[model samples]
Target: MSKVVLITGASSGIGKSIAVFLVQKGYKVYGTSRSPKNIENYPFELIALNVLEIATIEKAIDFIIAKEGKLDVLVNNAGMGITGPVEDTPTVEMKAVFNTNFFGAIDVMKMVLPQMRKQKSGFIINVTSIAAYMGLPYRGLYSASKGALELVTEATSMEVKKFGIQVVAIAPGDFATNIAAGRYHTPVFENSAYKENYQLNLDVMDAHVDSGMHPDEMAKAVYSIINVTKPKIHYKVGDFMQKFSIVLKRVLPDRVYEKLLMNHYKM
Candidate 1:
């Protein structure tokens, strides 16, 4: 029998790419969206699930288990993006992004673990971001949110290993997707200290997304991870420089790396 998979935030972008690829590969895949009903003619079933809502998460999981008898893989991909200067961004907005990207991912993992534990075998892949590796200017909160998920992925992997559940994270660099359209961008305040530079970085950010690697590359990475019997705790999918940045961070001094990022963003 084919493996059953559940992927959150599958209505578009990387999640959608992964879901469609898996379906073509013979996996029974279910993708989730906040308003799945509105989406039409999707290759796989689109279920109603909003990461911010615990009740919806529970219901989606239950419905999947009831139908499939087991959920073999979970792609915890649901998330939101927030962009702004850390100081100028509202604290509430910061909390909100963390709520969806960090707490929300954790909640889905929590809900699925019991079932995964019962099965004695499962895989959980958290879709993080390359930005998670280092704090980027004007996107600090988004970085923090994904970075937290990366750490949690590490801890959860070790904790659940004995139960035959493997948890890991895949951080992707800028992927050509509609993420920029959905991201919550705090306005570049006219009177704020970061206005000019923030505006500049925002433009650069969107341009990167516009020219990003195809989402299919991320899908291929996810597919490879799923097939591994002893997958690594972390995986990264991106262009050479994007992947190399993580290495540079490890080798470079604090201020040196900070300067590199500042130069890249022209801050």
Candidate 2:
């Protein structure tokens, strides 16, 4: 029998691409989104799920369990991006992004983990970003959110290993998608000291993402992870510079790596 998979944020972008790819490869895949009606007709079933809502997440899981008899894998890919000067960013905006990016992913993991524990086997592939390890100038909230998820991913692996559960976080470098369109930007203050430089770097951020790698590459990475029994605890996909940045941070002194980041952003 084919494995059963549930992927969040499947309405579009990386999540949708992964879902479609898995379906073509014969996995029984269910993708989730706030508005499932728009993409429910796709090859994979699109379920209505507002990750911020616990009850909806429960319902989506119950729907899968009822039909599949057991949940085999979960892809916690639902998330939102926030961009702005950290000091100028509103608390409400930060909470909103955290609600979806951090809290939402945690909730779904909690819900699915029980079933995986009961069955004695399961896999969770978290869709994190290359920004998970470092904080970006105007994208601090987004960084913090993914960073939080990465911490959870690492800790959860050790916690769930006895139950035969595998938790892997894939840090994908920029993938050309609708992430910018869906992102929430904190308002820039008129007298803000960081306004001018913030705008410049923000535009650079947008252009960089606009020319990001294809989502198909990320989908394939996820596919490879799922097929393996002893996959690594962490995975990085996309540009060599971004992946190498992770390595550089480990080898270089704090000030040296920090300087490189500042130079990259022209801050």
- Which candidate wins on lDDT? 1
- lDDT (10s digit) by residue, model 2, range 150-262: 99999999999999999999988898998998999776678999988888887897898899999999899999999997999789997889899999999999999999989
Q: What TM-score does structure 1 among the candidates reach?
A: 0.99
Q: Which regions of candidate 1 fall more than 4 Å away from where they truly are?
A: none
Model 1, 1-267: lDDT tens digits are 899999999999999999999999999999999998755678999999999999999999999999999999999999999999888999999999999999999999999999999999999999999999999888889999999999999999999999999999999999999999999999999999999999988899999999999999999999999999999989999999999999999999999999999898887
- For candidate 1, the 10 contiguous residues with the lowest summed lDDT are 34-43
Q: Which pairs of residues collide in candidate 1?
A: none
Which stretch of 10 consecutive residues in model 2 shows the poorest summed lDDT? 33-42
Which residue ranges in model 2 land beyond 4 Å of their true spot? none
lDDT of model number 2: 0.91
What's the lDDT for candidate 1? 0.95
Our model 2 lands, by Cα RMSD against the true structure, at 1.1
Q: What number of clashing residue pairs does each candidate have, in the order they appear? A: 0, 0
